[model samples]
Target: MPTQPSLTLAQDLCARLCHDLVGPLGTMAGALDLLDDDAEAAALAREAAASLRARLQVWRAACGAGTGPMTAPEMAALLEGVLGGGRVTADVTALPPGETFAPDVAQLLLVAALLGGEALPRGGVVRLAPAEGGVAVLPAGRVLAWPAALADALAGQEVEGPRQVLAPVLVRLAQAAGWAVSLSAEALTLRPM
Candidate 1:
């Protein structure tokens, strides 16, 4: 089993979340100041608000308290809200339409999506699909480079820092649920143990 996160790691993650929120919050603040004078600013404010909400929702599922069962559409919406506007696009169409994932599995899928996105720095599709043993997170792009730290973490090695936190958390989550996680240049696969 993977070790639990330490208090320091928790603090670092908090800092990371704050850092992620600051940009959208700053945009909203600036837009608010110009809202009275410019119609464009109102549009900007609305966009910023949506972005902020999406980030919060995604983070809640990724790092916050356990969410109950989630359907494929629900997860896809959350992924689209945060990752769609950027270079990466999320594809959950491979997931069954009527099926719901248990809370832990849902969380795993979200984190796996995030991790897959990280590897596609150049832009690509992050796809979630049912695998023979479990689920597969397949990220395809012109170029793919998996972070060494994350790979180490998946291998059950001790890694530090907020950026590297997700990999270990994923390992722990899968372990707790009796699943095995493996990563490759092609995909991240989680299988029943």
Candidate 2:
């Protein structure tokens, strides 16, 4: 039987979702798979669920989803949420006491910061510093691998398949928000003014 367009789209979405969720979920799954039996797996699964839950809750808070206002404490939780293991550590020496970006800004900034974090594989410091208007992404160290197509997206180009993921989206985001960007071979900093 010929596949319906809706089925095709659904299949495509499923593939994308699996591909995206696979990494973290797989890590959790792998941690469980190493266990002896269902009982062990169940326990490990609970831990994994806790991790995912914490990450999701902080992400939701950072993105300002269903939240009327985001505060400094909430942002701190989000910071700690994204940092797992000794991979990264955030030092919020001074966070704005009672200020938060709009929902769209909050979500986009969170997404951009998360994307920046992914660029550092061996894992270094990624700072969300206060810039002129928006913020600056300070990802230190080498092994930085931002998707190349990101530049094109910044120049207002549509990206093709198997690409257009994080960095590109960040470029597009910076553009949309009137955020000015300064990029080196190793870093990308943006400020909206």
Q: Please provide, for model 1 over 1-193, each residue's C-alpha lDDT reduced to its tens digit, 9 standing for 90 to 100.
A: 6645576567667876787789899999999999999999999999999989988988899777757789888888888746634578889889897998888888888888888887888888998898966889998899787767778987778877777777777777787768888887798998788
Candidate 1: C-alpha lDDT: 0.81
- Give one digit per residue, the lDDT tens place, for model 2 in 1-193: 9775435434543453445445667767876786665566767677667766656664455322435445545554576646523365454334466777655555556656665666666677666666655566666646776656566656666544333354444554565666676666655666664
Q: lDDT for each of the candidates?
A: 0.81, 0.57
**Top lDDT model:** 1
Q: How accurate is candidate 2 locally (lDDT)?
A: 0.57
RMSD of each: 2.9, 5.4
- The reply for model 1, stretches above 4 Å from the true place, is 1-5
